[model samples]
Target: MLNKVYFSALLFLSLTLNAQTSPCKAAHIGKFQVDSGESGITVIERNKKTQTEINEKMGYKARYDIVWIDDCHYELRNRTVIKGKSWEGSSPTDILKAEILKVVNGKVFLRLGSNFSDEVMECEMIKIKS
Candidate 1:
């Protein structure tokens, strides 16, 4: 029984430490490719991003904007550009707002809540070393 309890405690502590100091944190700050089913795959970069690079084979174009509301939270534009300008303060649509801007298990995901659809969706992004 003591051995079981010790193992469990050690496992929990290890997981907590890893989660807090994840090397995958790089995935949150650079360019990444994400597979969006019919869209196949798309490239997302820091700040300025073009959604049309989804995939020629898939014949699907993506449209989105990731506006960093803060370091850890983000808001997306329902429209292509933010208030017809790329500036942060410009009036952007809140229809695609997302939060939880952290990385986990070598991937960064944006939780889509009531923006693109009524259901909650998670879009994962891989890190680009460049």
Candidate 2:
């Protein structure tokens, strides 16, 4: 009696947790665009196999090497300077951690974290190309 109820509760909890997990999938490999309210349009091109990302925002182009922490989260380390730009003073390497918060109807909700702060920004990206 009591044992059966306990087992059912545990099972329900497990199923709820499983359903809430957001996993990264191959469908995320593509070109996406985000229309930032103030910053203008930002485009992101991602290659899952190479773990590389190219971002264009407000006319500046940057590249990053991505390291996946899990199916839903990844860290991006800037790789843009290696392409030809000369490094000036000791500029801190820009890195950002991001998580796929949700994917619905070809759009992805992303939460991004910058190296300089604990604040997180949420943005929605639409898949432009696969």
Candidate 3:
């Protein structure tokens, strides 16, 4: 009877821990920072249907309309360049694909690519706020 009780307790504890570690879609709705190497850091804020990115060092800010294909994948359609005259060439029709490759602790590994180009960029974004 003692062995049975101990086994049940262990099973319950394992299940409880697994539940706690499960990922939620809403967890990614927050502010994050991406180190853009020579370009400096880019701060990104994600919401349900939109995402805003600001590169303070470059004096650039842009907003994108997000179309979530799935929990892990999404497309960003450039809506407008809120600041920076250099970004005026950005087309509203430009589409960028982004995927959340993995989330560990407070960092999210992302893969980004452009629909009009073959180039792909991968970076780790540190969560700044949730």
Candidate 4:
């Protein structure tokens, strides 16, 4: 009957639309909330606390801009902080490079290097609610 034909066409259309995947989708892109940590057993515990962190090279969490380059390629923007401190002997802003890294759980994860190299940073980042 015509009713059966109509139902089949509708089902096909639904499946086809759902099959298309885009990287720009919300499930694909999200704001990354990052936390910096230090090495050694003693320093590891302090890293978990947002205020009690011991790493000076890379400060605490910041909102990261994320862009999906491709299915496997992703990028992260420079760190951004709140209104710069106007206190005496204090720098207003800290500018960093756009560290292009890998994406996991809709976030950009970076692993630090052994010493001063980018090869040692081993931390996971998660998407932040804007």
Candidate 5:
């Protein structure tokens, strides 16, 4: 009886561990929204190799090529502006680095930075669609 109980507990533990998947993997293909302060909401849709963002209030829409450095680290490159003007003085060749800090509830927190500057921005994106 003791051996059976031990085996059952081991099985339960294994199942629990397997159920807890890494957040980065789940985030790869999802629709997320980030509040862009006064500019309104930025809706982002990401796939395996691309990310697209649209901010209607800002009249901005762009698509980026995604390069995954690791599980939690990735870079966005080759931005193609589809609508509105690009940021002043910003180049299309600039790379944006992002690190997944954590996912709480339905929100994903990130450490966002750029290859061209030392500035790092922290923001959270709410999962809209998985």
Candidate 6:
């Protein structure tokens, strides 16, 4: 009886670890769109080969250099100012980080900004193309 109980405990532990280690995949490298609840939609383009990302919304576009911390997390350094919008009063070198919280059925849930901060934003990204 003791041996059977030990075996069951080990099996449960292994399954839990397996679930926690499921990382994001390379197939997420592509463009995505989310409705902004306004007249325009927000577009995000990620290029894993180039290690870059472009975000466009409300006629403004910003580019970032991506540094992958792991398969599920990455840091984004704002490398360029919004081309179609004026940035005369703001710093051009802003930074942000993002993590893949979950991926289900080709849709990725992303959390943006520092995890310690209370202002983190969550967005769902659907792959549009490779």
TM, every model: 0.51, 0.66, 0.77, 0.28, 0.83, 0.66
Looking at model 2, residue 105 earns an lDDT score of 81
Candidate lDDT (C-alpha), each: 0.57, 0.70, 0.84, 0.39, 0.93, 0.68
Ranking by TM-score: 5, 3, 2, 6, 1, 4
The residue-by-residue lDDT of candidate 3 on 20-116, one tens digit each, is 7435364358998989899999999999988999999999998989898877888999668899854545568989998888888888888999877
lDDT: which candidate is best?
5
Per-model tally of clashing residue pairs: 0, 0, 0, 8, 0, 0
Q: For residues 14-88, what per-residue lDDT tens digits would candidate 6 score against the true structure?
A: 999877755486434777766656636666777863233333544567676777888888876655645565346
Error at 43, model 6, angstroms: 1.7
Q: After superposition, how far is residue 77 of candidate 5 from its true place, in Å?
A: 0.2
Model 5 Cα lDDT, one tens digit per residue, 14-72: 99988987777766788999997998999999999999999999999999999999878
TM-score-superior candidate, 1 or 4? 1
Question: Which regions of candidate 5 fall more than 4 Å away from where they truly are?
Answer: 1-20
Off by over 4 Å in 6: 1-23, 26-28, 49-57, 86-90, 114-118
Candidate 4, clashing residue pairs? 111-121, 112-119, 112-120, 112-121, 112-122, 113-119, 113-120, 113-121
Task: Please give the ranking of all candidate structures by lDDT, highest first, separated by commas.
Answer: 5, 3, 2, 6, 1, 4
- Tens-place lDDT per residue, model 2, 1-106, is 9999999999999999988745456335788888876767767788863333333433455567777888888887755642334335424376678898878788
- The digit string of per-residue lDDT tens for model 4 on 1-130 reads 9999999999999999879764334224333444533432211111111211123343432333444455433343333343332225423242222333565555645443321224433455555532
The Cα error of candidate 6 at residue 92, in Å, is 2.4
Residue pairs in clash, model 3: none
Error of 5 at 51 (Å): 0.4
Give the lDDT of residue 42 in candidate 6: 63
Tell how far residue 54 is off in model 6, in angstroms. 6.5
